[model samples]
Target: MHRPALRTLLGARALARNPARRAMPTASHYHRTSNEASTAMRQPSTNTPRPPSRTGIAARIAHQLLAPCVLALSLGTSMSSHGAGPAAAPERPPAGTDVDETRTVAQRTRAPADCLSVVLEGVTVLLDRSELSRQAHAKPTQWKTEAERMALIEGRRAAALLQAAAPAQGSSPACHPVTQTLDGDDQFVVLAHLERGAAAVLPAGATQPVPSVAIRYLGQRCGPLCGRGSIMVSIPGQPQPFMVTHWWAS
Candidate 1:
């Protein structure tokens, strides 16, 4: 019946008396529970959400086809915006190359004719019959009766020849009956005569006529000194006339 037996009997009596009183867990048990909780925290969780699954073959094929198209579209857009793409250049012929010889010759030939027409037209205006007669009579020189009569007749004839030879509507020929010679390269000397040594020489260009005192004097000198009647006209690109009149007073 000793102390151990008595202690056991007292513990049983307490348990019966306090049914609500529970046994406290040991420190080892608490340590084991803490280890289990730590392991649970360390391990990866399966409850986390997973990524959405892709359409296996169809998605891969679509990506493969669209990748090149997207890359090409982006490259084209960049090139167009920057203006860096190479382009074909227009072809140009070498400098000083003659394209059409025929056309060039035709143009060269046509220019002289046009200049000639201008000369004829200008001379015709200057040598009007009544105007020339008036100018002749107004001069200070006194001519013999026969010479004065001849001068008037020659002036009328010169005027008539110029008017008849000039173009009625358009361009006239380079060698009209009134034109004597066409001379010079850039400028032209136009000479026309109605009587002996009675001539007019004017400088004409493509557009304008220059006044010549020599020619005016020649036109006026027909009263006495003039011996032979001759006309000379010069167009551009021709030699100057050497002898304007065939005869002069001896």
Candidate 2:
């Protein structure tokens, strides 16, 4: 009986020492499967962000380049509008060569009711190509001089038309004249033909002499090529004779 008891005790002790061996293998396998499934169900991780595409990069570069060009073009246009910069003025051809120029002048006086003075001035001229050529010959060293030469000629011709219609101060009973000078402050003819819109109003294909009657006036004749200048005249005992004031030329 003792031996049988001892054998039973030994068998229990062996079972207690090896719990893994005593536990149900099926239960352990199920627990392990549950843990593995939980691990597998975790959320996926993200990767780092990518850079811009080639097309996008190229577009950005193009925009950067275009912005400066647009700004430069706009700046150039604004500078041109004010006539302040060194940019060249537009060149116009001389009158009466390709196109005809004619002018007329009329005057009224407050001092005398019967005194009505009228004069007409006109000329037909070609652009002095020879003069222009002479100026052009010096263009390499004197571009500004050449430019001034041409401009002076044009301005002078326009001034002559104005002088021919100058009002008179009755210096004599004949030769009513209109005039101006190169100086801006000097008095010019009240009926000067260089005024704006006069070109359209002037008669075509005719040159008429300023009449000399019932008034004294000084007349300054312009050379065929008048330099920038004006003519001056006065209407006797009048407050103001200039009905119009401004400059125009073809």
Candidate 3:
């Protein structure tokens, strides 16, 4: 072979034997390698966290729905621990005959069997034995002559007329009349007079002789002509038909 040809062949063999200079890469190959590297970087990683599954979402919804019930139970338990429990029922009265007996006993202890009540100038005036006795002795009376007796009656009538005409002054405490009866034959009567305040009594009746008195008014307490007023009497056993003296004023 020629010397130049032999040298060219030896250089080619040397280049092939050296791996670092074996071949030069093309532009398309370099572009393809760059694209693959970029794709790998952009892909999502298996190690990264993911969004919640359907089961997890359902669990959260269930917790929200039950939260109110759990809170209410806790509050109820706390209140019970503090002694705020359900209230007790009120006591009931006895039924039938037992109830009647209890009421009778109560009445007997509180007031006299023959007691009566009176109302005057919108005020409830309670009259008992002591009150009646006081009024009877308030003014000395000696109606020895028929003329004096007649005068007394006329004066009382005039006072009643005056009281009836007078305007009500003001209000007073409430006092309701009782309806329970004493012994069947026992009775009650209320009487009013012009010169006297008022009186409550069980007058002489067919069965009973002596009067069972409750209250009596002292005669004319304040006056230029003396306090003038009408009288009202309530009859026991009946509801209405009260006996009233004619209106009068001094």
Residue 237 miss distance in model 2 (angstroms): 46
Q: Count the backbone clashes (under 3 Å) in each candidate.
A: 15, 13, 10
Q: How do the residues 1-250 of candidate 3 rate in per-residue lDDT, one tens digit apiece?
A: 9999999999889887896675678899899999999999999999998999998987787656545533332221211121111221122221111111101000111222222343432322233333333323432255776444433433343233322332322322121243333211111112321112232232323222112212211123142322333223333333432333322232
Ten residues in sequence with the least summed lDDT for candidate 1: 100-109
User: Model 2: residues >4 Å from true position, as ranges?
Assistant: 1-48, 79-250
Model 3 / residue 123 / CA error / Å:
42
**Model 2: per-residue Cα lDDT over 99-198, one tens digit each:** 2222333321111221223323332111122222332243232236634444443334334433444454554332233333323211121122122111
Query: Which is the winner by lDDT between candidate 2 and candidate 3?
Result: 3
Clashes of 1: 15
Tell me how far the alpha carbon of residue 41 in candidate 1 is from the true structure, in angstroms, after superposition. Answer: 99
Deviating ranges (above 4 Å) for candidate 1: 1-144, 170-205, 211-239
RMSD of 1: 35.3
lDDT of each: 0.34, 0.32, 0.33
TM-score of 1: 0.23
lDDT of 2 at 149: 44
lDDT of 1 by residue, 1-250 (tens): 8999999999889989987665667899899999999999999889988765676666676657645543332221211122110221122111112221100011111222322232343443122333333433443344577445434433343334445444434434233333443322111112222211122334443233322222111211222221222223333344553224221121
Which is better, 1 or 3, measured by TM-score? 1
The 10 consecutive residues of candidate 2 with the worst lDDT sum are 193-202
